[model samples]
Target chain A: MIIAMASGKGGTGKTTLSVNLAKAFSQPVQLLDCDVEEPNDHLFLGGELLNETIVSVLVPEVDASRCDGCRACSAFCRYNAIIVPGKTALVFPELCHSCGGCIKVCPQNALKEVEQRIGLIRTWRSGGISLLQGQLDVGVASAPPLIRVLKERIEPDRIVILDAPPGTSCPVVTTLRGADLALLVTEPTPFGLHDLTIAVEMVREINLPMAVIVNRMGIGDDRVQRFCQAENIPVIAEIMDDRRIAENYSRGLAAIDHVPGFRAVMIELRDKITALCRKEA
Target chain B: MKIAFSTSGSNLDAPLDSRFGRCASFLIYDLETDQFEIISNLQNLTAAQGAGIQAAETVVRSGAQALITGHCGPKAFKVLSAAGVTVYNAAEGTVHAALNAYKAGQLPPTSSADVEGHWS
Candidate 1:
């Protein structure tokens, strides 16, 4: 079963919950960091780099010699990546969405598609858990493509835990689309509640069974709990506000390592998640 | 020489839209013919990304030598400047007023983008 841990607000402990939960399982598990823009799960896991793959997107390249000043490719390109002025077609790879419409519509056959490196996918193993992460190149606007590429590599036999990027945008949507359950990690602050509401709506739209985990439980009021109760969403667990957990996190250590009793908390959380998945099955 | 102004309405009396990429319409005026035409910018307004670059390409395709808009982004400015199109700042007023200002050379030509990308 695939479980996606997501949070609408950044710094809400999606990675923390995902990493610790993956480590809690005695059986081999798969941990996928779908936050391609900045994959930090490797920092907490501290595993050896097993394999790496570079991902590329096809962008249009124009040959001005064979082209007339017809502007056909420019007119056909929805992204406006191609600009045809007089006798040349200027291609902006950054703006290209890799749709290849410009090359198909070129009347003179002057356009050709070229591969442009967009991101990387790396796999690592530390103990029974195998970690896969997608790392998008800097200045690349799109992450959904890389996330899709990474999700395709998920092993079906093992239990998969996905660490989704923050927000209800395209990347998050792509990460949680096919998951068996969504584990929304949130805080008790107003910003947390506001964004959690958005995240819940997104999960509902995607038609996934989900529950909530309120991180930093003591930092704010009980409004998040009240809201969750009113919405009939289950609060699976709450990680109390502890300075030791924060210190361990800052030092790239999981709560299970430095904070006492945290291991049991994560183990119980993992069992609850397993039960939820079984209920769905 | 021909000039283009980002306008909210079809006629010369429309207000000058501050947004370049998401402008409702564009007014293209020819100095030799003394005639103007309004083209609706529906596609770029609804574009999720690259709207500025798309709008710039449309203006360049219209054969306009000068553009009068409230702001221009770096990417759009590069596209326009590469096509030898001079950019001018559109003052706060109707499209007709902006046209008159351009006629009187009151609008200054910009060497760089006045606003960052995706300003709207």
Candidate 2:
């Protein structure tokens, strides 16, 4: 079963929950950090770097020499990545979605697919858990392509946990696609409730089963709990507000190993997720 | 010579739009004919991305020899420059005033993009 840990607001403890849950699983698990912009799961799970693979996306390369100024490529591109104002086509690599529609629409065969480096995927092994994370190159406007590539590496047999990026944007959507369950992590504040409402809507739009995890439970009011109750979504787990957990997190230590009684919480959370997945299946 | 002025409305009396990419419309004024036409930029105005590039393409395709806008981004500036369209920074006034400034050679030709991409 694939479980994606997502939060609408940043710094809401998605990474913390994901790392601890992965470590708590008795069987081998695959943790994929789909937060390509700033993947920090590897910091908590200190393991040997097995290998790194360069991730690239196919973008259009226009051969200006053989091109007529037909503007067919530009007309077909929804992204407006290519344009033919005069006698030659100008291609904007950053704006290209790599749909290859421009190349297909080119009457003169002036466009061809070319690989553009977006980021790198690194694999690490820590005990029974295998962690894979994507690191996007700076100045890259898009992150969904790299997240899609990372999700493709999911091993079918082992339990997979996807550490999604914050927000309900394209990157988060890409990470949550095809997951068995979505673990919406949030705190108990108004900001958390507001974004969580939007996040719930996004998840519902995709027709995915979701559960809420309330982190730092003591800091904010019970509005998040009330909202979730009204929305009929289950509050599967709540990690209490503890300074020791924060200190351990800052020192790059997994809560399952460093924080006392955290292991039991993770184990219970893992069991609940497994039961929910079974019920869903 | 034909020049395109990014405007908030479809006439010379309309205020000049500071944003070239997401402008409401372009008022194309012909120097020789003393005629002008309006081209709506509604499509590019709501574009998810690359609005400047598409807007530049629109200006080039309109056969305009020059563009007058308050601020031009890097991508749009590059496109206009490559198409040999002289870009002039528009003063804070109506399109008619900007056109008069251009005819009087009071508007300075911009050597490069006045603002970064996605300025508006």
Give native contacts recovered, as a fraction, per prediction: 0.38, 0.66
Q: List the TM values for chain B, per candidate.
A: 0.96, 0.97
The TM-score, computed over Cα atoms with residue i paired to residue i, of candidate 1 is 0.89
TM-score of each: 0.89, 0.97
lDDT of each: 0.90, 0.93
Give one clash count per candidate, in the order shown: 0, 0
lDDT of 1 by residue, A1-281 (tens): 99999998999999988898898999999999999998999999989999999999899887778888688887787777888754688888988888888888888899898899999999999999899989999999899889999999898778999999999999999999989999999999999999999999999999999999999988989999999999999999999988898898899998887789999999999889999999997
Q: Quickly count the clashes in candidate 2.
A: 0
Candidate 1 CAPRI assessment class? acceptable
Q: Estimate, for each residue in A16-122, the C-alpha lDDT of model 2 and write its tens digit.
A: 99999999988999999999999999999999999999999999887888898899998988888888767888888999898889888888998889999999999
User: In model 2, which runs have C-alpha deviations exceeding 4 angstroms?
Assistant: none
Which stretches in model 1 have alpha-carbon errors above 4 Å?
A69-72, B9-16, B90-112
For model 1, what is the error of residue A70's alpha carbon versus the real structure, in angstroms, after optimal superposition?
4.2
DockQ of 1: 0.47
